[model samples]
Target: MDNNLTDRSFWKAFWESRIGLIFNIKRDYIFGDMLGKIKAKKGYQTAIELGGFPGYYTIYLKKYENMDTTLFDYFVHQGLVNELLEVNGLKETDIDIIEADLFSYQPETQYDMVLSFGLIEHFKDTKAIIATHLPFLKDNGTLFITLPNFKSINGWVQRKFDLENYNKHYIESMNPALLASYCKELGLKDVESYYHGKFSMWLENKGTQSALAKAFVKSLWFTGKVFTKIFPFESKALSPYIVLKATK
Candidate 1:
């Protein structure tokens, strides 16, 4: 882990850049909603975020919710940890840092929420990937999962523009429905799915694209927003990402 990544100077620079803007949008739209639901529920005590590198979402949740938080990742990015703590006005003791792989790791106790983002899609066995986390959740605990939906128009655009890490995704057909089915198979009740992230937000984070490509994306921003506003239902269906909320 690069210390520079968490250093206040580097964070300040990135926070002022377009990538930071994208991150803020993602956090607000994704984490904000999910954490709101978590806090709304009864008996919400602790949350454990798997694959929480840099823990941006975890940090945000910690700021609002009065619960014990834990971050589990195979590799520890100390810079991200420090940056999150400092930015969120949290201390080292405020959150637990665990260095462990999900496959072989088991918790001594369960949490009120077991969360993971952009994780299960990387493995061939998505079922087992999710099942592995079951033991870490308390009875009636919520399991939240978010992944890139490669079946939408946003997916086609990302592919056409070569803006995604295709090789990193084990399957091309990942969607909320498929994930919901997995939860059902595992006997998880009250499953729900949502689509989020329009083209403009996706393009904003694609900071490495060519100048002409960026200009093309910029042109579509207003049109996309207008289309989404007029056809909100359709827009959600064509959104770039999927989030699954289920009870264990």
Candidate 2:
């Protein structure tokens, strides 16, 4: 059974917005720092990102870590993925593309790294969904997962301003401690999970918003950027993402 809370149309509209064009220094910093830590552990050569479409993170893995990466997605939005690759000065051949469903598809070979960003939280069965990625990872290979921390201030903003978007995510799976517990329960070694970014009002909604609400959100976003710049820190209440790292 397809357990995805989000459907193809949601992804299609999401990719069409081209929100990646807007750059956030804080977001980049948090992601880059995490990747650096992963790189420090070992030199990973090959990686596969499950449910990764329009492959921005995979591009970063290639450019920064010099990993041969593969993007595995259903390709319901293939045109947008192709366009993104072209815009990034990459051809379709530059990165391996696998069109498959995450729940049932089996990889031909395992990889040094198996990752997914903001993917698993859409499913109702968090542990079951996470276990599906393990088969694609080689022994001692790293498993990295990141999901929006919707149990924080950002959650409040999302719930109030974008209830529709908030409802799509499985809130029970948003806890860092719970994520860590799940990884450990799956028999992964050295499991670690924690709140990631300091603060950010980043929302995935590109839909219409009230002028007052937009201004309020923007104010909070600006304040968060300035505050994080001065004192970079993350806590359960303020952080925007939860990162989980483990080894198979």
Candidate 3:
């Protein structure tokens, strides 16, 4: 049985309201910088992002790294993806978009880089979900995975303000060390995992927030943004994400 916590309808509705919004925070820049550094070393030619619907991060790979990019997702919002691509001065033809389930789809060729941003944590079996990406990676190819650090201060805030969204993620898969260990056990080389990004208090609740709750969350987000600007730091207890990088 498929034990994925989220479904197509959930994502469809989620993207309905966010079709045109491209909110780039400091963490996004940090992640792009990380990608830039990796690109500098390997000069990857091709890349794919599993479960990448609107293809946000993959845009960075396409634009900055000059990679032939593909976004594979179970349910892709093609119109939204096109809109985002247009905003970045890229055409829909620039990215090859394949709409298919991650579990059932098979590619004819592997890629130099395989990525999944905030995808694996939705499934109950962390290792099984992660294993799905390996077959699509070429030998010596890089595998990058990132998930929200829901055991930290961000998790506490989400539980307080956005419990519905918090419950959707399998918190057991949110540990960097555990993720790195899983990569090694799966026979990946040079596996490295660590906490990523500075403090962030953003929540992704589907429900409407009370005025007081909204104010509090806004205040927290503002404070976090300021702190990110002044004293940028990443720690297991405060960072909002866990990143895993490995080679096949």
Candidate 4:
């Protein structure tokens, strides 16, 4: 590869690593509630995250439940995942960090909870997700998911283009109803969807037609809490990201 391409590749990897680790480590409190939902049913012992970006969620879950879990992903973002683990004072053996694409890896056992946040929407084949991802769930297990929604104009445009790369994910925005169907297909019951903060919620509206789109999004982000109070479920009303809590 040329220096430019190499540089881009390195930065891309670095970006994924750093953001994956530092960003969004905090529990998707909206989604994390599903962990409790799962515990109400089967109870978890061994939990695994398929596309753990920087091990933020991995470490968070470990600390939250005192879990000795597994983190799996190819670590395409330089060595960000590995670096984060070490920085967090986690030893190599402390986690089963699989630097491999999850599509090819299969597990021999089942788990009590299966989490794939910000992951499912990347693929087009929802069936593959059910095949590879949900099986980790033990009976009555809980599976938590977040995917991009196409309810707005920007998301619609992204989904309309050459989206083959995200064939395994949403690559497009999503409809909660459709996602609920997928959860049902996974044999999960009591499926519920949630969104965070008001900014993301306002973005969910099909208000992309407004010329002041950028300004509108900014206002929503800055004052989403106010908006949420005035318009709860506004996240679902405006944005594409939704948290699904389903039981098997």
Candidate structures ordered by lDDT, highest first: 3, 2, 1, 4
lDDT tens digits, residue span 1-248, model 2 = 47778977787676677566523223254476677567667777888888877677766676566678888886546666667666666666778888877777978989988989889999999999999999999999999999998898899999998898899899999988888888999999989899887897666663478788888999988887888889888988788988899999
For model 4, the local distance difference test gives: 0.58
What candidate 2 gets wrong by more than 4 Å, as runs, is 17-30, 225-231
| C-alpha RMSD values across all candidates | 6.0, 2.7, 2.5, 6.9
Instruction: Select the stronger candidate by TM-score from 2 and 3.
Output: 3
Candidate 1: worst-modelled 10 consecutive residues by lDDT: 1-10
The window of 10 residues in a row where model 2 has the poorest summed lDDT is 21-30
Off by over 4 Å in 3: 19-30, 222-232
Q: Estimate each model's TM-score.
A: 0.81, 0.89, 0.91, 0.69
How many collisions between residues are there in candidate 1? 0
Decoy 2 TM-score against native: 0.89
Q: What lDDT tens digits, residue by residue, belong to model 4 across residues 174-199?
A: 66667677777767798886653344
Q: Given candidate 4, what's the lDDT at residue 158?
A: 41
Task: Supply candidate 2's per-residue lDDT for 36.
Answer: 57
Question: In candidate 2, how many Å is residue 101 off?
Answer: 1.1
**Candidate 1: C-alpha RMSD after superposition:** 6.0
